[model samples]
Structures are given as structure tokens and as C-alpha cells.
Target: MKIDAGNVNAVPSKRLFLSIIADYDLNRSICELIDNGLDVWTRAGRRQPIVIDVHLDPDEQSICVEDDAGGLPREDLGVIVGPGQSGSVATAHETIGIFGVGTKRAVVALAKQIVITTRYQHAETFQIGFDESWLNDEDWVLKVHQVDDLPVGTTRVELYQLRLLLDDDNIKMLRHHLSATYANFLTNPAVMIRLNTVPLEPRFFDNWAYPPEGSPQRWSGPMRTPSGKLLRVDVIAGLSKESSPATGDYGVYFYCNNRLVAPAMKSFEVGFTRGQAGLPHPKVSLTKVIVSLNGDADEMPWNSSKSDVSTKHHVFTALHDWLVTVVKHYATLSRTWEGQWPEKVFVYDDGDITFNEVDDFLTAKRAVLPNLPVVRPRLPVRITKANSGVAQAKPYVVGLYEGVVAARTLVKQDLSQRNWLAFNLLDVSLTGALKEYLVNDAGAELSSLDLAQLINRDRTVSADLRARVPLPDPLWTKVEQMGRLRHDLTFGRAAPKISDEQLAAADAIVSEVLARLFDVKLAA
Candidate 1:
């Protein structure tokens, strides 16, 4: 064979790099190691009683983990603890330990030194000591010794110079986290995990059985991802009455592989109720939708922390779109159910509830109203120039004086109906030749109508009354501008005669319209 080398000193490419930089907490790292070890133990089909015992002494700053798995064989000890070597998942299957570096990296990352002792089923027992300096020292020897008698199948790892300890609270938290993280395994009688001396009790959500006789409306189905993988979705919809209460609780939850991924609806950045859709006095209890993506769905490109899904993944995009459609569909169903029931009669309770609570409740409730048209106050026809010369008919220029006056009247009416007469009123008086001429003529007709109805009628009224009405803009803008102005003030370039009282009244009318149509509180 002829050998030809173009670059003899070329370096081989590295396949993987350490993703985490900072030192991890010792207690947490130990837990992670145990979790990885358990995965390795279970996959080997050892079947022997497996146990993890942790001894923590804060004063000594040391922690130990002993597991009864088929302990490391004498020949495999070096490779098992070697850096960048993975024994788990050499075959195709969903083995929890994808990378073999978990235990080795975690111990080195958390503690100053680690000691390992193992007793194989039919091989001589051996012990090894590992330290940070050993990583770089090729000549450094590991303490390995053969023992005559040892536990049949046990591996013990002792971490010294620990950075932290597991207190009572932390132990409790660890128990909970372990139970949740290994829920499926915890249910298996073959696998047992204990924290300190206490055996962990796994509380799975699926264990909560439904009431037999009285069951909530529920829909359960399997959703297939673009890859043809199945994800389970289950929803428990509230009763029609429950769906639209004046104030109610409604929400959805996300799960992955039977694990609750996100527990609260607030985490989704969307409300549980229909208020998001602008319903007035909305009392819709949310239909609780619970979803569970399959375990294999981890390929969907979830973030490393698993807090959120990556939008770049097609599966995530499909899931997001599906959830949105579900929300909209349920909202429509809730509204339909609410409409079937009698209109809710509201009685203001001033005695029991605090004013703030009442205000907040009202504010939230008002966000659910259906959209309605707004009425603009009609301006009065004003004669700007009347009978300027003798023998001449009244040469009259129509002004918006009547419209301003009508707007004020409608505002006062709305205030009285809504019990908001205490609001501040700025006084404005109209002046200018047009106003004077209109006041002098005294033949203009101003009708008394709802402010909303009037606004709806005249929102399009331009400077030229005969011109077509412009499309109505957002109500909030109009209401805000009206509220900030001084009374009887002229707006726009044309100095039309307007009074402060009229402006205040117009503001009140706009506020009333918004409250009724959109459940928007314009006063504030």
C-alpha cells in the first residue's frame, strides 16, 4: 500500500463541546448523577434491588450516593468514569442518558474530589479516587484495590469538599422533583427511589380519577404531528353557565409525556376568560384544555431548559396554531352557551365588597362586551349671516352650535343613567360672529338623543354638511381628545363655536358609548 500524506500535522475535528460553563450546585449535581445512574442501571436489565442512599453532613462538606445496580465491572471501571465516554444508549431507544458525560462531568463540575467503590456480581471489588488534577495528569495513578468480600451488586460514589448541603426543605423539594421527573418509572414496582431514608410517593395527575356520576364535558383525542407522531389532547369544558360568569376561572395546561410542562394559564400570556375578545360583563369560566405531547416529541426542538418550544420547528408551529384555534372555538362555544341562558341581572353590592374590588371586577367584566355603534351629538344649524341688508332674505351660514348643544344634552343624559354625575365638568362658552349670529337667529333645531346614537349618526359629518361622512376611527382616540379639551373650545383649523360645557358633555357621551359598546372605561 502506498501512503500519501498532504498534511501530517493536521488536527482531528472535535465532535462535541461542554455546553455548561459555571460550576453546578453540588446537591443538584448529585441528584442529576443519580438520575443518570438509574437510567443506566434500568437499561442493563440487572433486575436486582436498586437503591440510592445519600449521606449529607454540612460540617464535613461531603455527600455520598450508593446504588445497588450491577456494580461497575473491573474491566469497565476506567471507561465508565472516563471523560467523554458514554455507556448508555449505544443502541436505538429512548434511554434517558443520551450523552455518557453526565455523571463524570457533574462530579468534576460540583466537587473537589470524588471516590468510587464498586462490587460486581462475579468479579473482584475495586475502588478508585478521582480529583480535578487527575484530569490533566497522564502519569497520576488512581487508587485501585481488590477486596475479598463486598456487596453483591453495589456502586458507591462519595463526593468530598461539597459546595452545598441538602437541608430539610431542600430534601423535600428534591423528593418532589424526582417524583415528577421520573413519574413513569416511579410507578413501576421494579424501580425504587428514596430521598434520605424516605421512599418517594409519586403523585401523578393521571391518577386523579374523574367523578363517576357527574362528569364535566370532556374531549380527548390524539393529535398527529407532521412527522406522524401522536400527541394526546384532553379538554374539560365548563358548563355553559360556568363558562360565562360575571367573574370566573378558566384556563388551559400544557403537558409533555404525561408531565405537566406549564401549570398555569398566566404562563401562556393569555387570560382564561373571554375578556381578551372584548365581551361586556363577561362571566365566562374557561374551558380547561389539558394537552400532552408524546415523549418522542422531544425532537420538536424544545429549548434546552424545556421552558418553551422553538418556533422554528414545524411541530411547534402546528401546535401553536392548533391551540389558537382551540381557544377561539371554545370562546365561541362559551358565548353561545351564555346566550342561551337568561341575561344576567347585575345588582351593585355596595355593602360587602370594597370599592376597589368592585371597580376591578367591573373593569374586568366590561372587557367582554360586544361591539356596538357610537352616536355622535348633532350640532345645531346656526345662521352665520342673517338679513345683512334690508329687503334681503336672511343670508344664513349654518354653524355647528346646535350640534355642540345637542352633544352636551346627550352627555348629561348618559351621566344620569350611569350614576357618574360627580365627574369634573369644565365650562366653555361659544363666541365669534357665527355663534353670535346663530344665537341672534334662534331658529336652529337640536334633538335630544342618546350620545352614542347621535355620534353614530354624525361621526362622518365634515365641514360641508352635504358631504359624505368619513369612516369612524377608533373610539378611544375620540373619547380621549374630547375629555382633555377645555369647555366650549373650537377644534380643528375652522374656529367653529363650541362651549366648555359642550366639550365636557361630549366627552361624557363618548365615555358612555365606549362603556356600552366595548366595555372600555373611558373616564380614566
Candidate 2:
């Protein structure tokens, strides 16, 4: 082999396409483009509110993300396709683009043909296109052309000939993903993002608080990394608004440089132990942990996709123990609150439950979390040890009334259930009593006309009988009443409806019938 030059050919192979984009799905890919626009806006000092519009046209099999953030300078536009090249000039703590491959990877992952149109501030519009041909070859050369009649001072990325055509479900998911990913940015009154003409609404935590005593905890401090970068960390743990226990909506969330890197993470990696021993309990569904890390983008403990945390990273490793401790503490408190705490309101006795936002706590001055007021062991505790004298007994009386109402409700419910049960007992008892009197005692067959006649007679007719038979008038009357009541309840007949008094009478009748007739005593 003749070595004309010692330089190695380092052009990226076509296989690089799969490697760069393999991990991204439709939602995350779109997020990468959004991140680029926001990063550019930050780099340009955010002179005006950045308006990013995402339009997903399934019928056209295309997506267009246009942003009013300052467009790329023509000289620097090559960075869009050049691996490791970047146009961002943001400081370590201000940017979201770190590896500089997010835009290119997102473009290729989405479509075969990509057209990026841009116009630098007060400059002629320029456009560049990347197609299947360019993707198939190893050539790094690209041509940018001046274009007219285009939007000025803006950048537009259009992806057509989609690699995976979007459907309704994909569009819905993309909307949600973008809403969550840029929640911090969208919270700014200046920023506006639209998806399919509808404005994007950010999803942030709605934490619960009973102020002065029970509020979310906050701890924020700056730490110097081993590499000497200043990293700021803020951790807030508290109760969130009610959500389904089965959902991932109530757990640890991570944000790096105001971008949501992970949402509602409740696995072993984030201090939720495996199995039922830990956070899986329904009582802890209100638990919310928000961790904000703002610092050098490269130093943050996040993966390239920004979809997960890099647990092995030293920064995260240092944070893991503390994170676990904090989560466990709040999770225990959550369980306790659900199990013991009364209605979470500032007023102790009576008011609708109110909650303060988690952001309020996150922004508060750093301090040790105040211990929650001792949750009364029982709800509506009107007669605590501190309570004294006759006037204070008014609280006890009010509590007694409330208790009476609740007890009455429960008793009525039990009575209703017992009525159905008593009906069942009536049928069985009548049959058993008849068998005992006719067959076992009087030694007569059940089919005998005399026995049937004896049992079927109404209370009036049976009242005249003086034969000293086991078929008594009282039993007959009780059976008839129970049967009619059962019929009325089952068929929605008129009332003499089921009540506590009626249930008690029925129970007494059943007990007498069982003991006097069927020989089975009702257990006390």
C-alpha cells in the first residue's frame, strides 16, 4: 500500500445516521428543535418574546417548526448539518445545546427531506436543504442560497417526506411533550408557543400547603464541581394536588437549565424502593419532589437525549443520597398526612382545602423545613387535652352532633343490608319451622293438604286455631310482613321504607323465629 498521506479518512459513515437518531422518537425529536430555538433566543439575549410555532400536518406527512428567535447567520448556518459544529454562543449556564448534534439528529430522524430557511437580523433570507441524497453520501459539503419573499428575522425548519408519518395520537403526544418540556420557559409572560394554532400551556406542579405550619420544604445552594464549574441545585419536596395513585404524576421531577429532563420519576433510581415497601403505597400519591439544576449544560447529570438522568454521574451520585433522604422524609409525611392529618386548610376547624403552588416554595429563601404541626391522631378532635371547662364542651357537643350524623348514616346503611339478609332468613326459617312442626314433630309429610292449609292460612285464620301446633299465628304474621317488605324493596313498591326501627324489629323477629322455630340461636 502506497501511503500518499498519513491522514486518516474520518468522514462519518451512513451507519452514523442510525446511531445518532436511533434513540429518539417523534416527540423527543421535535423537542430537540424547540430546544435549539430557545437556546438561540437565550444566546441573543432574549430581546423579545420568542414565538415558536409547531405545525404537524399528518395529511401532508410533514412538520414545520418556525421561531421568531433570531435566525442563524449565513456564515454559521453550516453548523446545522456539520457534526460537532455549533452556532450557539451562550454561556455554560444559559444554553441547552451541548453536543451540538440535536438539530441534525432530529432532522434526519424525522424526515428524508429537510428545508431550513433563515434570515439573520436585517439580512437577506437564506435557505438550505438536506435530502436523501446528501444523507446517503459521505460528502460534508452543503450549499446555502439567498432567498427572497420569506419571513424576515426568523428561522423555519420544515421536514417533509417523513420517515415515520405522524397520526392523531402522535400529534397529541407531541403537544403534551412540548408543553411539559418547556414549562419553565412558557411560564414567562413574554414567551408564546403554539402547536397547530392552539397555544401550548405549560404543566407545572400544583403543590399543597397548609400555611404557617405545613408547607413544602426547600433547599438551594451552589456547589463547586470537581471541574471547578459552579452548579446551583434547588430541591423542593411537598404534597401535590390530588392525582390518581396509578399514575406517574406524583413523584420526583428533574429540570436542568429550565428544561424538564425527567418528569414524575418513581423508580428505584430516584429513591422509590422496589415493591410495596416504599412509595408504591396509595397514601403517598400526593408526594411531589422537584429538583432544579442550573449550571454548565455539559456538567449536568443528564443523557444526550435529555430524557433521563445520568445516575452514575458524580454530580448526581453526590445528589442521590440526599435526594433519597429528602424523598423518603416527604413520602413518610405524605403517608402520615393522608392517614392522620385533617383537611389541609389554614383554618383548623372549617374551610375548603387550599393549596399553595410549589413554585412559591421553590422561590422562598433557603431554610430548614419547619416541622409540620402535630397532625391530630383523629379527625374532628374537639376535646383535646388542652380543652377545658363547660364552654369548651360546646366543641365536644358539635363534634358529637357530627359524629351522630355520621354514625346514623353508617347505621342506616348496615340496616338496609341487614334487611335483605333478614328476608333471606325469613324464607329459610319458614321452611325449617314448617318441616320441624309437620314432618319431624307431628310426623306428617310436607305435601299433606292439611299441612299446606295450616301453613298457608293468614294470621286471622291461623289465630282461631287452638291445636297447640308449631305453626303459630305470630310466626305467620311475621313471615307475611317480611315477604311483603322484601317484595316492596325488590320491586320498588310503596314505602314503609327500610329504617333503623324496622331493621331492629325484623332482627328481633328473626331471632325469635330462629330460636323458637329453626333451633339456631342468633349470635350476640
Best by TM-score: 2
- TM-scores of all candidate predictions against the true structure: 0.46, 0.69
Tell me how far the alpha carbon of residue 278 in candidate 1 is from the true structure, in angstroms, after superposition.
13
Regions of model 2 farther than 4 Å from truth: 1-7, 90-93, 209-214, 274-281, 336-524
Model 2, 290-316: lDDT tens digits are: 989887777778887888898898788
Model 1 misplaced regions, further than 4 Å: 1-23, 26-28, 46-49, 78-84, 90-92, 136-150, 205-320, 323-524
Q: List the residue pairs that clash in candidate 2.
A: none
Q: Which tens-of-lDDT digit does each residue in 1-524 have in candidate 1?
A: 87876767443222121235143454446555665557557566636656767666556767777777777777777655654555554233334444455576567665667888888766778888867566555543466877655677777788886545546676666666666555656677776777667777775432111221112334445556555554454444322323324333344455554444443243233333344422323523434444445435343334433334345665545455445444444454444334222222111111121111111111121122122223222222121122123114332222222233344444434243221222222112111212323233433343434222322322232232112222144543444354444222333465434444544555555444423422333222
Write down the TM-score for model 1.
0.46
59: Cα error in model 1, Å: 3.8
Best by lDDT: 2
